[model samples]
Target: MGPYGVETLPPGVVDVPAAPAACRAALVERDRFEWRPADGGDPAALTEEFLLGHGLAVDDLTRPAGHDPAGPCGAALYVSAAAGAAMAGAPSGAANPVATLPEVAVVVYGHARPPRPPRRTEPGRWWVGPWRDSWTPGEHADAVQAVRAAIGRGDVYQVNVVGHAAADYTGDPRPALARLAGLPGARYGGTLHGAGWAIGCASPETLVEVTAGRVVTRPIKGTRPATDAGRRELLASAKERAEHIMIVDLERNDLARLARTGSVRVDELFAVRRWCDLWQAESTVSAQLADGIGLAALLRAVCPGGSVTGAPKRAALELIAAVEPVGRGAGMGALGWVGPGRLDLGLTIRTAAADGDRLHGWAGGGITWDSDPAAEVAEAAAKAAPVRALLAG
Candidate 1:
């Protein structure tokens, strides 16, 4: 029945052209905005205003000190690892702090447009050239040794060492991104495109997810192949297990700041999970938000996930910057949706970015004192192989 006794639908009153596709999420061409840390503006504040402009509630969001609250809403979010480090004032290995990319890239769409179908593409038109590693195997090994030295010096317990690879490609990279989004066991997988660039993320780790009112984060730390032997090896290795626990602890601490007193809990601990051909140790830590916890506060607690940065995030980031040759562009960041009172982001581990004429990717593992340099280097290769193979075709 209709409200106030009106007919739900009066007979034969339909539009001649019918209606829009209700199931599709298309875009308006000019909705994307990129925020660079070097720009001397605030991403969180801009986001709050963007949501407010869309008529969403911003009063519930946490505001910067001495700043007033505004409204905010639906947006596509991409937070680069370098951006996170830059915000924290962590040193970067590269001379440029935030790289050429924006620290935070946002696409503000309230789903007001009609659907746009995929562009016409030839089956074999896509081309990804051979990859060139930014750091040779010896260099990667040296980074691992450096991390071990840091641990020995009592500077850091562990640090994640990542290696970058780049290649030239022709044609659109969206096809490659689409293929990656469909990878097996991808919980929070998708592609986000910005000015002259795009990213494909097939990461299994859940950086953070907020639903209803509860917040949760899954940090993945240790990895081995998805084999019977690999499973046993991963579960049995004291080094792997210890490494995994350290990250789990770090996540707990990160979330505790925002959590209600005595509301934090570890739902799952060091469970082996499969992501394509690899097995990784992941833990689930969840907490109930304290009174009035907002989007900016949540993002501040856990972007550039601890699993990617290693234990004691600040020190690890500094050491990592000094060790790694190139910056971690789109890798080791967060990507996902942010809507009214909701956020679900995944860490960019097995992720690749297409910038200008080049496609870039990075992979690596946590380096503890017990870490073997050669093994760490090989592990990074193993993680990156599948993405490279999928893009090659």
Candidate 2:
């Protein structure tokens, strides 16, 4: 609710009927607006009240903020399943599951109408795309240094490390996006092809979603190129299986933390999701939320995603902090929307963005005690391929 006590629509609900199936279509046909990621700042402080803005909205408007339980600041009117869980509920410092999740059904999801693309207003200067200067080229050494530091401090046994590079282009992003979306290994595909902000992603990974009070979280733990006929053989390697199992166990624990006693269970384990370029060992964990526990509260208990964060979440976050730059700028964030007591969301992986001066992209690999630093570095490079392609061309 706004300060004037106006009741806004819950997160993920667009006024258009086509929102559920084709959010971009509904948005393009309606009021044209330029939107970008907010700096997690005070909305009231912004002076330019353009006809529109773009950002996420979370599920369950009723869930109170951790620092202020009585107030309201639902951030976005729509939130992705991941952000919902990440931003929802109070900070759990390890306690009874109920204490951490005061309200169990909080669903995470959000919506963003496409925006007029960002361009250089100055005719002489061209926009090179969003710059992630915080992480620069030849930073593999930096990543390794950070990891070693974390290990030295006992912050984590292993933490996934990411690296970023830029992709610059001057033409319409759709063609580039279409090319990626049509790739051979893409199992999940979507494009928010706005005049300004274009996200063409083909991800075989499903972070989390909920419908009819049922919560589903699918974690893609392993990835290998599909062009290789021996992809299954590669996935069967002990290292890959161990990586997948650790994540599966982490996911199960995450769900079980919020699910009813004996209600949380694994729907599938070590399942394969075949995509255009990659074959993945994905796992599905699900559970029934307690009665009267709205979606907003549910998300608060989990977020930034367990798959990305690794097990022993808080420790993992600290480990990530030691390795990463301060501003993620939507890199590991979640996107999509929530509304009408149901939601659909996807991880913000395989994404590219233009923020002011530079174009940027990122990719990384999960790390375990068994991980090889060189192999992990290669994985990060492999993931960056599409992002670089989008802008390089």
Q: What does candidate 1's lDDT look like per residue over 1-393, in tens digits?
A: 001100121221111000112322343322556776566655656655665565545435332222112322255677888767765557645632223456687665433233455445456567878899988999899889989998999999888998899888887776686578677877766776655666788888888887666889998988899999999999999999999899999999989978889999999998999999999888999998787877666776786689989879999998988988788888898887665665677888898877667788999999999999999989999999998998776
| Per-model TM-score on C-alpha atoms | 0.87, 0.66
Clashes found in each candidate (C-alpha, N, C closer than 3 A): 5, 47
Give the Å error, residue 387, model 2.
3.8
Q: Write the per-residue lDDT of candidate 2 for residues 1-393, one digit (tens) a residue.
A: 001101221222222111255333222222222222233421211211211132222332223223121221112222222233235331312211111111111111233334223222222222244434345545665666666666566766545565555544454444444444555454434444222233445555656676655677888767676556647665567877887777777777766656667878888888766654456678888887555454435444556676766656667765665566533433454444444444555665675543222344557777765666676776676666655654444
lDDT of 1 at 219: 89
lDDT of each: 0.73, 0.48
Pairs with steric clashes in candidate 1: 51-71, 51-72, 51-73, 52-71, 52-72
Which 10-residue span in candidate 2 carries the lowest summed lDDT? 96-105
Off by over 4 Å in 1: 1-30, 58-73, 92-100, 113-124
